[model samples]
Target: MIGGGAAAGTIVASADPSLPDRSAAELLVDLQNAKVDGLSGTIVQSADLGLPKIAGLTADSGGADLVNLVAGSNTARVWYAGEDKARLALMGTLGETDVIRNGDDVWFWQSKAKTATHLTLPADAEGKKPAALPTGVPSTPQDAAEQALDAIDPTTEVSTTGAAKVAGRDAYELVLSPRASESLIGQVRLAIDAEKKIPLRVDVYGKNAVNPAIRVAFQQISFDTPDAQQFTFNPPPGTKVNESTAGKLEAELDKEHKAAESSKPAPAGAEQPTVIGEGWASVVTAKLPKASGDEAKQLDGVIDMLPKVSGSWGSGHLFSGSLFSVLVTDDGRVFAGAVAPETLYKAAAK
Candidate 1:
C-alpha cells in the first residue's frame, strides 16, 4: 500500500496550515505553470507489477531496476540544477550506480561492473536541448504525472482528493481515474506541493484494488540548489568506457529498430504494435519473432508455467498478475495490457 505522500506528509517543513481550497480546473492550471530552478531530494520507488517469480531474472543496471515494471523497490538520491546539469545516484544490493549529466556530457557509471559509458551531444546554435533521449530509463512518477496532466480528456475523470501532508509539507491531491472499464488502471493520485506547485508523490492503483501497485515519491526534499561539483564525473581506473556521439547513438538506435521490425512476423502494411482500442482498456498487439531450436524449447518451458487458453482466433498462453496480463499466441503474436485477461482475449480475437 502507498504509505503516505512522500516525506511531505511526514515532515513539517512548511508552515502552510492546510492545502489551499481550489477547484479541479484551478489545480490543473497551477500544475501546468509549475517550475523549479533547483532542487535535491531522496526518492523511493516501489513496484508490485505482479510479475511471475521467474528464477534468475535479475536486472543488470541500477537504472534499469528503477523503471522496470517488475517486482521490487529501490531508492535514489537526485540533484537537479537545471536542464543542463543533473545527477542521480541509485543505491542497490549490487552497488551504487550513478548517472550524471553536465552541460553537453552524459555519463552512466556502474560501480559493480567497473564500467562507464560517456556520450557527448553536438552543440545546438539555438541552445535548445532535444525533447528527450530514449535512454530506456522511464521517467519517475512525478514526471509521468506532469506529462499526463497535460493530456486531460474525456477518457479520464479528473478531480481533487482534498489536502494531505507530504515531505513534511501540506499538499493537494489531484486524482485521475480512467473512465473505460477495460482499463486495469483504477486511478492515479498526485500529491502536489501546495506552495511550490510541484508533485512530490505519485500513486497508481489497479482496478478494484484498495492499494497502489506502483508508487514513487520523495522521502525528503529541499528547494535549494544542489552543489555544482555533484554533476562532474571521472571514470575510475580499470573501468571500461564506451564513448559515443549523439549522431552515432541515433544511427545505432535506427539500425536496431529496423532490425527488430524485420524480425517480427507482421502482416503486410501492418504496424508492429497495433492498438485495438483507446484509453485505459486499450490493448497493444505485436507480432513477435518465432524462436527456434533451444530457444523454442526454452519458450515452451515458460509457456508451460502460464495458464493455457484458446478462442476462435487462436490458442495462447495467458499470464495474469495483479495489474497486468499478457497473452502469447502459438502463431508468434503477443498481446499485453493493464486490463483484464478477458479484455486481452477480446483484443486477441479481433
Candidate 2:
C-alpha cells in the first residue's frame, strides 16, 4: 500500500491530549473507512505561497479570485447530511456566496451579484457530486486531506507524529513527505479527529520552511444533524436565475470530446502537453494559448513583470514560489510543477 516514501522530520506536539497511539497504516485505514451522517461547521482556509504581490490581489478582492485563494485567509460555513445533501456558504466583506445541494437539485447563489444557477442531476448518475465551493478553494479539511492522501505511494514516508487537539476534540497527526529531492514540497500533515476518524485539519509546508504554505482547518464544528432548511434556497426578488440539466452538460461534454478526436492533429510539440518525470518531480510542458489584440497585450504585460532568465533551455520568464515553479519560454511554451526551478529547466530542455 505504500506508494511513495520520504525522509521523516522532527515531530512536535501541538497539545497534550491523552489518546491511544495509532500507526500510520492504521490511521490511513481509519480515514478511509470514516463516515459521518450529518454535520455543520465553520471552515477556515489560508495560504501564504510566497507569491509576488500584485495590486487588488488581497483577500478583500472577491472571495472567488485566484489570487485571493492562494495568498490570504477565507472562511466558509459548511453543512453536510450525506453525500447528496450539503450546503456551503462562503462569507466575504460585501456578501456571501452559497452552494446548496439537495438530492438531485443543486443551486449556486451569489448574493453580491444577485444571481443564481440551478442544475438538475440525471436520475441514473448515482454517485455524481457537485463542488462545494469554487475551483481553487477546498471547502473542508476532508477535501484537502483527500487530495494529499491520493499522493501517497511507495515514494512517500507516512507516519504518526503524536496526539493533538483540534476544534475542541482529540486528534492524531499524520505526516506525509516526498522522497524525491526535486520536489519543492517538504511535507503534508493531516489532523484526524480521534473519535470520528475524519480529518479536521490539513497543513502543507514547503521544503525546509518553518510555517505552512497552505492550511485548511475547522474553527468550529458540530457532528449533530443540521436543520433541513439550511439546504433550501429561495432566490431574492429580481435575482437572475439560470437553469441547466445534467443531460445537457453530458451531451455538451461528449460533443466536445468527439470534436477534439476528429480534428486534425497538430505537428509534434505544437499545442499538446508533455509530461516529464513522474510523481512529485513531474513537470508538465505545453504551448501557451494563442492570444491577440487586447488579450495579447495583457499577457505580454504580465509576462514582463516576471523575472527573465536564459540558458540552453532558451529565454523566458520564471515564476517561483515556496511550493511550485513555473517557466514560460520565449518559444511559446510553458512548464510548471510542484518542483524546484532546476526541475522545470530540465523539462524545458527536453
Q: Estimate every model's Cα lDDT from 0 to 1.
A: 0.73, 0.82
Please give the lDDT score for candidate 2: 0.82
Best by lDDT: 2
Candidate 2 lDDT, 196-269, residue by residue in tens: 99999999999999999999999899999998888889999989998988677668779999997666455444
Q: lDDT at 217 for candidate 2?
A: 94
Local error of candidate 1 at residue 159 (angstroms):
0.3
Q: Which candidate is the best by TM-score?
A: 2
Residue 313's lDDT within candidate 2 is 85
| Candidate 2 lDDT for residue 305 | 80
Tens digits of per-residue lDDT, candidate 1, 1-350, equal: 11122111222222245444666666666777888888998887777877665433324344456445456677778888887887778776667778778888888888899988788877861243323423333345457676656545567777776687877877888787777888788888888888888888888898888878888888899999998988889888999999987778779989999998888665555456888777667788987655678977887887777778998878988887777788998877889887888888777777
